[model samples]
Target: MDNNYLIIRIDEQQNIELHYFWPSSMKIKYNYPTCITIHFDNLSSCFSLVSLCYCFNILSTSHKLYIGVEVFKAYLSVKFSQSYIQE
Candidate 1:
C-alpha cells in the first residue's frame, strides 16, 4: 500500500513474472498477468525496452502509467535463473 517494491523473475526459458511487494504489510501480489512468456528465435530479444524498463526500475507498475512513475516510490529487484546467462 505504501512504498512498494517491484520484483521481476526471469526463468531459464525466458519466462518473466512480475510482483509487487509491500514491506510494511509483508505482502506480494502478482501483476495483471501471473506470467509473461516470450518466444523468439533469439533469446536476446527478451531484453527488450519494455522488459528492461521493468527490470531496471525505469517503469512504474502500480500507477499504471497515470503519473508515469511510482506514486509511493518503489524499488526494483530482478532475479534471473542460472540458465539465463548460459543461454
Candidate 2:
C-alpha cells in the first residue's frame, strides 16, 4: 500500500494551507499568527513553513529553521530513492 500524507504550509502572511493528495484530494486554507502553533492530528503528515522573506525574494533574516527543514526533506528523498533502487 502507498503511504498517504498531508502537507501543511504557512505563507509569509501567516496564512495556513493544508494539502492532502491520496485516496482523496482536499485543501483547507486559513490564517494563523504563527506557523509553529499549528497542530496536526496525523503523525505521518509533513509540515512546512514559508516565511515572507523567502517568498518576497528578500534575504532570510534567519536560516536555522528553513535549513533544518530542507535538510530533513533531502534526507527523506534520498532514503526513499535508495529504497526504490534496491527493490
Candidate 3:
C-alpha cells in the first residue's frame, strides 16, 4: 500500500506551509510512520547562512535535515561581468 506523505515548505517570510499528499490506495502503516519532506525554497534569497543554521538548530529536535543549494548558470553569468578591465 502507498504511504501518505506531507510536504512542508518554508517561504521567504519564514512562514510554515503544509501540504498533504495521500494516494487513493494509501493506508496508514502503524509500523512505518508517515514521512515528512521539507523544501526550503528560495532560502538563500530570504535567509543568510548563519540564520539558516540557527533555524536548523531549532528544527533539529524533531528530525534530521539536510540542505542542498542549486545555482543557475545564467545567474552566475550575470553575476560575473563580461567586460574585463585590468586595474
Candidate 4:
C-alpha cells in the first residue's frame, strides 16, 4: 500500500473531485479528460490519478470509505495504459 492519501472535495460546478498528492516522477501533464495528474512532491509510485472515483465505485456499491491497495494498483495500471495510448 502507498503511504499516500487523497483529498475529496466539490468544485464550484458541483463536481466531486479527488485530489492526490503524487510524487514528481509520477506526475505527468496529459490530455486525459475527467482527470488531471500532477506532481505534489517526491514520494510513492508512478501512476494516474484519473477516474479514481469511478474506480472506487467499481469496488464499493455502498460507497465505502476506503479501497484495497491491490485493487487500486490494478485499476491504475489499466487506466494509465489507456491514457498512455491516447497520449
lDDT of 3 by residue, 1-87 (tens): 223433444335433333434444645453333232223344344324423443233433223222222122222322453222211
Number of clashing pairs per prediction, in order: 0, 0, 0, 0
Query: Global lDDT for candidate 1?
Result: 0.37
Q: Write the per-residue lDDT of candidate 2 for residues 20-50, one digit (tens) a residue.
A: 3333332335332222322223213323343
- Cα lDDT over the full model 4: 0.36
- Better TM-score candidate (3, 4): 4
List the lowest-lDDT window of 10 residues for candidate 2. 34-43
- Candidate 1 residues lying further than 4 Å off, grouped into runs, are 25-62, 66-87
Q: lDDT of each model, Cα atoms only? A: 0.37, 0.34, 0.33, 0.36
lDDT of 1 by residue, 1-87 (tens): 235554454545544444444345434463342233433232345345335544335434454453223211111112222322110
Clashing pairs in 4: none
In lDDT terms, how accurate is model 3? 0.33
Could you report the Cα RMSD, in angstroms, for every candidate shown? Answer: 10.6, 15.5, 13.1, 15.2
For candidate 2, the per-residue lDDT at 58 reads 36
* Cα RMSD for predicted model 2: 15.5
lDDT of 4 by residue, 1-87 (tens): 443345543334333334444334445585232333333221132233443444333433333335234334334544454211111
TM-score rank order: 4, 1, 3, 2
